[model samples]
Target: MSILESLELALKNIVSSKTRTVLTMLGIIIGVAAVIVIVGLGNGLEQYVTDSFSDMGTNTLTVTVMSRGSTRTLSVDEMYEIVDENSQYLDLCSPTVTMPGYVKIGSETITSTSVQGVSEDYFSISGDTVASGRGLQYSDMAARGKVCVIGAYLNLAYYGGNAVGQTLRVGGQSLTIVGVLAQTDEDLEEGGSDDCIYLPYTTASRLIGDVSSYIITMQSEDYIDESVAVLESALYEVFASDDYYTVTSMSEMLETMTSMINILVGVLAGIAAISLVVGGIGIMNIMLVSVTERTREIGIRKSLGAKERYIMQQFVIEAACTSALGGIIGILLGDGLSIAASTVVTRLMEETLTVAPTLSAVALAFGISVGIGILFGYLPAKKAAGLNPIDALHYD
Candidate 1:
């Protein structure tokens, strides 16, 4: 028979036994859906990490100094001099001094607020803007002024949005709020990104020991490796050893996070693919039973001069069609689940993470399902083709 005629026959058989066909394809459906969902979740997580890194400035590098009993410590002026010398590679430098203390506003004492010492250039490097009043000035650092900038959370929650020129005590020292930063987060809550404070590094160092950390921005992100090498080399010369200081680039950290996510997704997808094999086995077993049930039909066709190749072609096509149908259903189910997962995650975690499945993943899954069907269907088709016409004809 022609291929089209055989395909028509295959469809009729599949339709006549609806329940059995669905049961056989269940494995393929579940496997494809599981793989797609897992891959989509991985994609969302990677995107979230990349976005978080981008907000923190990927062209920036963080340098931490650890005192290894060496009296030769790198001073803030020396650090600035290094950046000034390498003006082509480095653009901005700011010494970060974290002050440990609770913020006191009137009778309310808030310990959740983070107080840090930075420079006038720190706002530009961190992409923070002054919503009211003015940001830290160079004079503030020069004279060790006690002026500070407050985040939106403090401005709205404590000062009722007019925080500039307000007085707040940090580490028992009274500091005037010179500026209120523009809100970065959608919802301003306590201990969030919007709840923080910034002052001059000079003032903070006097209160909280010496400055041990610095944030430096590069002139160009395209030359991150060259810039990092120059910075590390300069720090090495200052301490005379690499053991006293460490330089880390945000771009390098982002790449490492993405690579780790990819590896995790690959392992999970591999595990979910095992179900496809189980589904294939189910198809094979069902096809073998089908061949036995249609023995009379096979015998009559063989007796009428039907070829063995034609019998094999019909059975193979039937299996492939069944698998293809299952794959289509699986793709639809996976897409629905992905959307639901995105919504549920967003509501529960309070973050917008979309679970989006890629087109390539869907296509590959469909192809694999069809391939499995053909592979498993071969043995049953072969057995049906090899049946003796005389014996099949006499058998009940």
Candidate 2:
């Protein structure tokens, strides 16, 4: 018989035995759905992390001095020298010093207010804009001026729009607010930019007593690795010990995070594969029972000159069709569930989480389902083909 004829015959048999077909397909359906959901969720999590890191910009690099007891620490001047020497790759650099202070407005006292002292390019490199008045200038750092820039939240909460030119006490010293930063989404959260006040790094060092770290914003993302290597060499020349200073780029860190996420997704997908194995076992079990139940039909076909290969082909195709159909339904259901899961996570996390089922994942799940049917159906099909016609005919 032609393959098409065998396929048609298999379809007819499945329709006639609807209950058995559904029971046999149950395992494949659940398995494919589970795999798709697991993989879809993994992809969504990876995307979320990527988006978060992207917000920080990949061209940014941070350098920190590690203090191991007697180990030498990098000075602010050394940090500048490093940037100045590598001016070809670096667009801007800043030494930062941060401390916590109190902001008092009459009887209202907002404690734990962050005070950061940085260079003039701090705002430009950090992607912040000055909303009103003006940002810190070279003169501010040169003279260690007592002027400060305040975040949007600080201005709105305490100064009530009259923040600029107002004197605010930080660490018992009065600082005139020179600028109010543009409102940023990050400002709404605790410890975000909106809750901080900025000062010139020189002035901030005097307040905080030390500047141990610096950030170099790269002019181009393409040279991040080369830039990091150059910076490392320069730091070695300055500090003379690798343990004293560490250099890292946001792009490199992001790449590592992406690799970890991909590994996690693969692991999760493997765990979900257990369900497919179980479904395959179920298919084998059902096919075996089906072979026994159809012994009479097998005998009649054999007596009418049907070949063993034809008998086997029909049964295998039937099993494959059952699994393939189930897999199709499972893909649809899995897509719906994955979308629903994304919605639930978004609501819980207060962030938009997108779950998109990839075509590769869908194809893999469906292909596995069909392949399982063929592999598991083989033994039962061979058994039916090998059965003696006389014995099968004699059996009730």
Candidate 3:
């Protein structure tokens, strides 16, 4: 029989056994939909993190001392020396020291307040603007000034009315609020930019003791390579080993994150693929039952001069159609679910997340389902084809 005739016969068989066909297709539907949703979410998370870091600017570099290495303390003087030596390549340098403490205003005390001791250049490097009053200045650090800058959350949470110039006891030290940072959508968690307090590094060091790291802001992206080289040389002289210090640029970090995201996506997709395997086994099992039920029909067709290849083709085509139909429906449902999930996440984060399904993912999912149909349908198709017509007819 021709391929068209086989397909027509297969369609008739499928229509006659609608309930069984639907049950067999269920597995394919679930498997394809799962693959699409998993891939969509993985890609969306990667894009979200990439955009977040990209917005922070590529010209910035952070220098940190490794925790395991030598315990030699790095000082404010050493930090300035490195900055001054590479002043031609660098625009600003800020040393930061963070401590866990509480901010007390009479009876109202916010516990575990994030207090960052930073230099005058911190504001410019951080890309945040002062909402009121003035940012820290050279004089403040030089004088070990008893002044502080509160984030947007702190200003609104406790000191909404005339926050600047108000005295708040921080870590048992009386410090005047010199500035209140502008409200920002970024940093939505505790210890984030919008929830922390800033003070001059000198004063913070005096109160909190010791600075751990420094953030170097480059003049432009053009100077990153040269500045990094100069900074690394300086740090090498101080620490004497690559293990003692780490100088990393934002661009490098972005690359690392991209690699990690790709690996994670691959791993997640692999896990979802397991369902497709199970779905294929279901198709095979159903096709075997189908072959047995139609055994007498097969015998009559063969006795009337039907070829084994034609008999096998009809069954194979029928199984493929069932799986392909399921795949199409799964793709549509998966796409809808992916969009809904993205919308919910975007609202909760107050930021846009791209979770749109890619063309490649749709094609891949559909293709896998169809491939499973062909592979699993073959064994039963062959089994029915190999049966002896006389024996099949006599089996009742």
lDDT, model 3, position 326: 84
How many Å off is the CA of 242 in candidate 2?
A: 0.4
Q: Write one digit per residue (lDDT tens) for candidate 1, span 1-396.
A: 999998899999999999999999999999999888888999999999999999999999999997656578888899999999999999999999998869899999999999999999999999999999999999999999999999999999999998888899999889999999999999999999999999999999999898999999999999899898998898887778998898999999999999999999999999999999999999999999999999999999999999999999999999998888888888899899999999999999999999988999989999999999999999999998999999989979
Ordered from best to worst TM-score, the candidate numbers read 1, 2, 3
Per-residue alpha-carbon lDDT of candidate 3 for residues 70-113, written as tens digits (9 for 90 to 100) = 56546678878888878888778888888666879768887756
lDDT (Cα, 0-100) at 33 in candidate 1: 91
Better of 1 and 2 by lDDT: 1
Local distance difference test, candidate 3: 0.84
Worst 10 residues of 1 by lDDT: 66-75
Give candidate 1's error at residue 296 in angstroms.
Answer: 2.0
Residue-pair clashes per prediction, in order, are 0, 0, 0
Provide the overall lDDT of each model, using Cα atoms, as 2-decimal numbers.
0.93, 0.84, 0.84
In model 2, what are the clashing residue pairs, if there are any?
none
**Model 3 ranges with Cα > 4 A deviation:** 1-4, 55-58, 66-74, 84-90, 186-192, 218-229, 303-305, 343-355, 390-395
The runs of at least 3 residues in candidate 1 whose Cα sits more than 4 Å from the true structure, single-residue gaps closed, are none
lDDT of 2 by residue, 283-359 (tens): 88888988899999999999999999999998899888888988998898899999899899888987877777799
